[model samples]
Target: MIVFDKVTKHYGSHKALDDVSFSIRPREFVILVGPSGAGKTTLIKLLLCEEKPTFGRITIDDKDIHLLKDRYIPYYRRQIGVVFQDFKLLPNQTVAENVAFAMEVSGKPDNEITKEVMKILELVGLKDKASNFPRELSGGEIQRVAIARALVFQPKFLIADEPTGNLDPVTAWDITKLLLKINSLGTTVLLATHNREIVDNINKRVINMDKGRVVRDRRRGKYDYK
Candidate 1:
């Protein structure tokens, strides 16, 4: 479980997040929706430990994340998988290598790395593109590779930030279905997106934010924004 206890973040004199509080239970799929500069990104940063909260506490699985030492931050981060709007892949590496690189950096054995890479590629429906490079694939395919890379470690939580922003509507829907599939298989998903169509269609838990504060939180909620 993830808990945010009155979390607040400040940048200079500006408050990016204002006493935000929420809890995400295990295996629950939740959407974080808000307009630009509404603190969505800041909240994610705090969760990832990229930035510390100026006030409040964040706990994951009962451990206070902010109290973790610098040496333990990397290990803490490995517990959550993150995907972004931009597909960040190595131009020089093939799809298989790109996925395997995550395990490689963590010093996993070659045999285990290969096995896990193949499994994750198959999970993301991109096993056939294993040998292909990023430049040879379409935008959707690139995002699939990114998702596979994020899942290679088999993290308990997945954070997707505008994952379908760069794709067409059809491709975006496909990606959304893929995320739903993953969530159904028991990975807790926190999707931060501005796409109302996806949010309303999914109809899961919705937490709406505005001006750095949570305005509404509902189960099976719709996107109530312009």
Candidate 2:
């Protein structure tokens, strides 16, 4: 379980998050909706332990992540996978190599890296593009490589911040479906998106934020918050 208890973050005098509280259960698919500067990215950053909250506690699986030692931060982060709007793939690396790079950096064995890279690529429907470079793939396929790279750790939580921001509607929905499939496989998904069509169409738990505060949270909901 992931719990955010009265979380608040301050950037100089600007509050990025204000007294936010929520809980995410394991294997749950949650959509985060908001306009610009709604604090969505800040929330993800807190979860990733990239930034510490000025107040409140963020506990994942019962551990207060902020209190973890610096040496342990890397290991703690391995438990969660993150994908961003910009599909950060090396232009020079092949799809398989891009995915394998994550493991390679972690000192994974050559055999294990090869095996897991193929497995995750297949899961993302990009196994056949293993030899293709990012420059050769479509926008959606490039995003798939990013997702595959993020999953190399087999993270329990997957935070997708604007994963569809770079795709057309049809392709965006396709990626959404892929995320849904991944959630069905038991990884908790937290998607932060601005696309109303996709958000309303999803019919999942929606957490709407504005001015750094949660304005609405609904179960089996849409982007209808006002």
Candidate 3:
């Protein structure tokens, strides 16, 4: 479970997040929907420990993430996978290599890396493109590689920040379906997106934010701004 207790973040005199609090149960798929600068990115950064809250605590599975020492941060981060809008894949590496690199960096054995990489590639429906480079794949395929890489470690939580922002409508929905599939496999997902169509279509738990505050949160919620 992930819990945010009265979380607040400030940048000099400006407030990025203000007394925001929410909890995500295990295996829950939650969408964090908001316009740009609605504190969505700040919230993700706090969860990822990229930035610390000025005045609150964030705990995952009863462990406070903000208290982790610098040296232990990497290990903690490994438990949460993050996918970005850019599909950060190495242009020179094959899809398989890109996914394997995550495990390799964590010092996993080569045999285990190969096995896990193949499994994740198949999970993301990119098994046929394992040998292909990022430049050779379509936008959707590249995002699949990104997701596969994020899942290589079998993270307990998956946070996708605009994973489909760069794809066409058809391809975007394809990526969305893949995320839903990942969630179905038991990885808790926190998707931050501005796409109302996808949010309304998915009809999952929605947390709507504006001006650094959560205005509404509901199950089977549609995208609405008031």
Every model's TM-score: 0.97, 0.96, 0.97
lDDT of each: 0.92, 0.92, 0.92
Writing each residue's lDDT as its tens digit, candidate 3 over 1-226 gives 9999999999999899999999999999999998888999999999989999999899998989999999998888888898999998988999999999889989999998998998888888899999988999999999989999889889989999989889899999999999999899999999999888999999899999998998899988888963
In model 2, pairs of residues that clash are none
Worst 10 residues of 1 by lDDT: 75-84
Q: Report the Cα lDDT for candidate 2.
A: 0.92
Candidate no. 3 TM-score:
0.97
lDDT of 1 by residue, 46-113 (tens): 99999999999999989889999999999877778888899889999999999998888898999999
Q: How would the candidate models be sorted by TM-score, starting from the highest?
A: 1, 3, 2
RMSD (Cα, Å) for all candidates, in order, is 1.0, 1.3, 1.1
Candidate numbers sorted by lDDT from highest down:
1, 3, 2
- Model 1 residue 149 CA deviation (Å) reads 0.9
- How close to the true structure is residue 172 of candidate 3, measured as C-alpha lDDT? 92
Scored against the true structure, residue 187 in model 2 reaches a CA lDDT of 93
**Model 1, TM vs. native:** 0.97
Q: Where in model 2 is the C-alpha error above 4 Å?
A: none
